[model samples]
Target: MVIGPDGCGFDMRSPSEMEADDARREADEAAHAPRMAVTSRIRRVAQPPDGYLPLSLFDEVRLADPVPLYAFEDVPADVTGLAVDYLSRVARGVPARDAFRVPLAGARLVGRSADAERLLAMVDGFSDRSVRAACLLCGFDAASRRGPARWRAGRVIDPGPATVYNVRRMVARTLRFMDRVGPVVWEGFTFDGGYTDRVTSGDGDLLTADGLWDLKVSRWPPNPTYTLQLLVYWRLGLHSTHPEYLRVRRLGLYNARSDTMWSVPAARIGADAVRAVERDVIGYADGL
Candidate 1:
């Protein structure tokens, strides 16, 4: 529930918050920027003995190369990730009211406009707010509320048929991954507790009965940075006062674009590598 700067200290504040304390936030970011360089550290130090895509336990859950339900045109991966994540919640029966309340509230402040109404009508009801949230998360203001693809001339352009098709297709694949993994215990949660500081804090994607999972929409397989990110999340989870993370026995990546899943047991990651990241990159407190 605590929203702030992401792992690299990128300010995720609402537009209003940015305007209100821009100067102070910039100063703080400058002061802590060095410690926020966790991604660079991961590239340098985070290596697993078996490599990024270690043998998966779920080898039986085969997925074909992603085929678009509609004709495919390229879309931003970030936007696609957000849409699929939101739709996952809806598929799992999360009430529309429960998702994207933060960004939706921001949207409300922007007030109902013709574009907003048009957008709401465009999506299946469950995911309407999610599309709005994606817009803001991607970069929205009072000006660009309909999101990147659908915004034009200060108006909400109707989503092209193909865009909607691709989003639904991707969401279906994510649901397939979830069904294979097991029921989700948590989604869009941060490893909230003292282990995280302003610099090393981030929200993780999903946790199921099987393991902790991150949803990636990238076409490529898990890279060193992505693998290290998962490891760091696990360490933070263990260090956090939150007890639910103790249930995590594996770290996983589900690539929505490729429709493939990669996972490794916590024990498979090199202990020395993890320790090095804890001390050097994440900068966890002594004795944590």
Candidate 2:
């Protein structure tokens, strides 16, 4: 018998049908290719609002502060280091909770040393690599003790009894110095409110109605770099759209260890200096 079109062994499609199937597949691929191109273009154009400014651009900019410089003479190395660390915390407005969270070897040394001399001898004998660590531990320990009796009162978390009394003793002296200096409004004042994207941010230890103050807990005297740092802050403030920007009319540094404060007139940090810094920053950014 002759095979019918619906027979089980028959070829279902003709050559024309096969050609039409190939044409449809090619058309589908062509239709999708444009979509893929458009998607790629969108991705290429998408970018952050601030665009791509290198970090170096922000670093290159320097500002000026009119504050006078101070010289610290004949301060003990250990005392200076301790004072710098303590005052730096205070200046940054670091909460007692946060400061106490920092791990210190002094915490372990607590109740371990029988006397000050023994503790000193132990610390003195520490390897060069361990000396800084020991000092930091001692500083933290002393600060923790003094926190309860002073400004950080009720904030000191008990790491344990004091094993190093001398560290606490040194901390007490530093606290007294802080107390004698009296209170300033800008302690821990941060200038991040108006920071533009891709720009550097800064903070001052103290902010007054008329000026901004940076705290330096250092044995060394103020230098141009410090002044420039303050100057940059001033420029950032001046350029800021924030209402409080105008309030910062002065710049200065407070040497916590030396108990000295130096303030410069805001006017002294001129537009020229700001422009110069901006130029340098832009040049650097371009190079990158």
Candidate 3:
């Protein structure tokens, strides 16, 4: 069940209460918008450490990529999630099972929102039980779905106990990869801060002293959209929040499946390219 802000129990708001809550949240956000913008501007003017570019160049930048698997991997992973659904069909060469079972493998590979959070906590020296708890939660969530069995894309199939065992193995591999990478300043950091007033806000999987890294659980190198995502995070971090904490020199994508890392200097993401990304993203959002 969905938890509420107080965490005393599950969310149980009535329709009217939910609407009122939404309205209040919007109002509070509107009230804070000006202050946030001013803070962002002040941060931009501050000089970065040696070898780092100023944040001003990215103020007008926007992301051009669509909300596909490669582009939005920072979102919670699920078996039936967009990324897993695509991977199951194209990469895994496995016929799709019911929607509920689709996310079992992908969630283990990439992780769901709770899984990411728990992993971050684990890296911070929290108990290993957090990882096990996350795995169990995912499995429980999958098994709890109450719907008639349905085929995916006209493919009829069933995921058996072996599938569950495979998910556990994948989780162990993922955890091992994280251990190799070591600790970071932040993980699963969403630059948005739950406010959508500006274009800079987005997700950055990990933040380090030198750069922002996006974790990829894919076999291939990250695509252009993934590169663009790092650029966006760098831009957002530069202009907003603790600028000193975000004085990153580069952007990186870590391929967890391959245990490989790829990075480039942040300065190489030119203004012209950012402008193009901005145009495309704005245009797409407008169309939507």
Best by TM-score: 1
The residue pairs found clashing in candidate 3 are 78-103, 79-102, 79-103, 80-103
lDDT of 2 at 146: 31
How high is the lDDT of residue 226 in model 2? 57
Regions of model 3 farther than 4 Å from truth:
1-183, 192-202, 278-288
Question: For candidate 1, what is the TM-score?
Answer: 0.66
Estimate every model's Cα lDDT from 0 to 1. 0.61, 0.42, 0.42
Candidates' TM-scores?
0.66, 0.40, 0.41
What's the lDDT for residue 162 in model 3?
A: 36
| Residue-by-residue lDDT tens digits, candidate 1, 1-288 | 254566455556788877868878867875666443233345556455753434443232347854745545344555567667766776787754444443344344555444344443444443545454443332222123333343333333334556556666778899988888877898876766634342354667898875998888776666667876787778777877878788888888898777888888776666666766676667764423
Off by over 4 Å in 2: 1-94, 98-183, 196-198, 240-242, 282-288
Backbone clash pairs for candidate 2 read 63-232, 64-231, 111-163, 186-206, 186-207
lDDT of 2 by residue, 30-118 (tens): 45542211112223332234222211222121122223223322323433344344434533465432332322333334432333234
TM-score of predicted structure 3: 0.41
> Candidate 3 — what's its lDDT?
0.42
Query: For candidate 3, what is the total of clashing residue pairs?
Result: 4
